[model samples]
Target: MTDGQLQQLVSQISLHDFKRPFRHRAYFNARLRTTGGRYQLESHNIDINPKMLTDFDEKTLVGVIKHELCHYHLHLTQRGYQHRDADFKRLLAQVGGSRYAPTPKKQTRLAYRYTYQCQRCGLVYHRKRRLDTQRYTCGRCRGPIKPV
Candidate 1:
């Protein structure tokens, strides 16, 4: 969704769930890596990871928004806003917000192109490129190795 849509959603969620208005900005932040959303204490703005919408469902997106809203409301009211605080925990549970943000899945790539086995020790090694078996020996027992 666009930044304007995100702002509207956050505002709606805040009022509907928290019984308070979210007066600050809420926008997609591509730089957000690990966390699904962040509530800035200084600016009172909410930064949401755009990948959450692209990779997850609307339910997941709403959960993350609720989680950030918990922080926003609590902080604005001078209540416990940090995750470890009892007040934060209680309000988050009451609002049915997600306790933990979902981590993004990483793309996997094959790193090894070849495998070798030591003739004597049977130790195996994986390499991205071919190795000169004649010059190199097994690291464990100094035994000869052959490509497998």
Candidate 2:
């Protein structure tokens, strides 16, 4: 959805659920990596991860919006807005908002630290950390281990 649509949706959700008007901006933020949405304390603006809509459906989008709205309304009313606060928890539950934001898919690839091969069996293994090739042997054939 567009920024204008996001703003409208936030306003609608705020009025419908909180019985309060949302006067701040709501826009898609591509740089948001793990979080589904963020409510800025300084600007009172809400930044939603664009992938939330692209990767998920309307229901998920609504839930994320509700979650961010919880932070927005709570902060604006001078109540507990942080995730750990009771006010935030209670209001979030009352509004049926998502408890945690959905994590975005990681784009970067992982690095492999170690590679091992079985001398007799010719089996290979990839590991993040180095293992002692002298002590460890192949499980299938009891073969000697060597670095690949």
Candidate 3:
């Protein structure tokens, strides 16, 4: 969804669930790597990770919005806005906000393309890239190696 739609959703969720009108801005933040959303205490704005919608479903997006709204509303009203506080926990539970967002899957690959054996000690090494035999040697016997 776009930033405009996100703003509308956040406002609607705040009003419908918390009985409070959210007056601040809400927008997608691409720089958010690990967090689903962040609430700015100074500006009262919400920064939502775009991955919440792209990686998950609409339900997950709503839950994250609710989670950020909990912080927004509680902080504005001068209550305990921290995660460990009783008020924050109660409000979070009442609104059914997600306690934690699921981490996105990583795309790193383990591809061992080259194998080398030590001449003297017979030590084996698996690597993704080719190593210069004349420059590198085995750790155990300090012997030269050749690719297998």
Candidate 4:
């Protein structure tokens, strides 16, 4: 969704869930990596991770929005808004907001390319680079290692 849709949704969720209107901007921020959304205390604005929608689904998006709204509403009312605050916890649970954002799915990249096995012990080791079989020996049986 565009920034306009996000803003409208945030406002709607804020009013519907918290009974308060969100008067701040809510938009997707591509730079947000580790978080689904962030509520800036300074700007009172919300920055949502675009991946929340693209990589996941609208359900995940709504959950994140509710979570951030918890922060936004609590902070504005001068109540306990921090994660450790009881008010935050109570409001979040009351609204059924997600406690934590879902982890984004990442592309799997195999880092190890080469595999070495100890013939005697049947132990295996994976290495990103080729191993020097002539110099390395199996730790388990002190046997010669071979490329597998």
Candidate 5:
């Protein structure tokens, strides 16, 4: 959705759930990696991960919005707004907001540290860490494992 749409949704959710208005901006932030949304302490703006929409459904989106709104409204009202705060927890439960943002899929690639070949069957093996070739053997043909 567009930024305007996001702003509207946040406003609606704030009014509907919290009975308060969300005057600050809410926008999709592509730079957000893992968390579904974040409430800025200084700017008071809410940043939502664009990937949330692509990966999840409307219910999930609403939950995330409500979660951020909890932070927003509490902070504005001079209440406990942090996750560890009792006021934040109570408000979150009342609004049925998600406790924690869903984690995004990890994109880091792992490199193979060792390569082994079966002495008799010629089967290749890949591993993330070095393995003892003397102890481990090929499962298919019971052949000795040799470093390749």
Candidate 6:
């Protein structure tokens, strides 16, 4: 959704759930990694990871928005806004906000390309780069290593 749409949704959620108005901007931030949303302490703006909609659904988006709103309102009101704070925890649970954002899927392939095994001990190891099997031995049993 567009930033304007997000702003509207955030405002609506704030009014419905927190009974407060979200005055700052709310937008999708493509650069946000891992986190589903973030509440900026200085700017008081809310940023949402667009992946929340692409990877999940509307319910997830709402949960994340609620989570960030908890931070936004608490911080603006000068209450305990940090995650560990009692007020934050109580408000988050009361609002049923998500405790953590879903982990984002990696867009790029993993770098690991090689696997090595100890011939004698059957110990396995993974490496991103080619291993010098001749030079490296299994520390477990001093056995020769071979690429599998």
Q: Which ten residues in a row have the lowest lDDT in candidate 1?
A: 100-109
Question: What are the clashing pairs of model 6?
Answer: none
Q: Candidate 5 lDDT, tens digit per residue, 30-141?
A: 9999899999999999999987888888888899999999999999999999999999999999999999877766667768878899989899999998888888889999
- The TM-scores, one per candidate, come to 0.72, 0.71, 0.73, 0.71, 0.71, 0.73
Compared with the true structure, the alpha-carbon lDDT of candidate 1 equals 0.92
Backbone clashes (count) for model 1: 0
lDDT score of model 3? 0.93
**Which stretches of candidate 3 lie above 4 Å from their native place?**
107-148
Flag the better candidate by TM-score, 1 or 4. 1
lDDT of 1 by residue, 21-61 (tens): 99999999989888899999999999999889988899989
Each model's C-alpha lDDT?
A: 0.92, 0.91, 0.93, 0.92, 0.91, 0.92
Instruction: Give the higher-lDDT candidate: 1 or 2.
Output: 1
Backbone N/Cα/C clashes per model: 0, 0, 0, 0, 0, 0
Ten residues in a row with the worst lDDT in model 2? 101-110
Q: Give Cα distance to truth, residue 1, candidate 1, Å.
A: 0.8
lDDT of 6: 0.92
Stronger candidate by lDDT (3 vs 4): 3
Q: What lDDT score goes with residue 34 in model 3? A: 89
lDDT of 6 by residue, 6-25 (tens): 88999999999999888889
Better of 3 and 5 by lDDT: 3
- Model 3: per-residue lDDT, tens digit, 119-139? 898999999988999999998
> What are the per-residue Cα lDDT tens digits for candidate 4 across 41-104?
9999999999899998898899999999999988888999999999999998999888999887
Q: Could you give candidate 2's per-residue lDDT for residues 1-148 as a string of tens digits? A: 7999989998999999989999989999999989999999999999999999988888888999999999998998899999999999999999999997777777776688788999998999889999998889999999999998
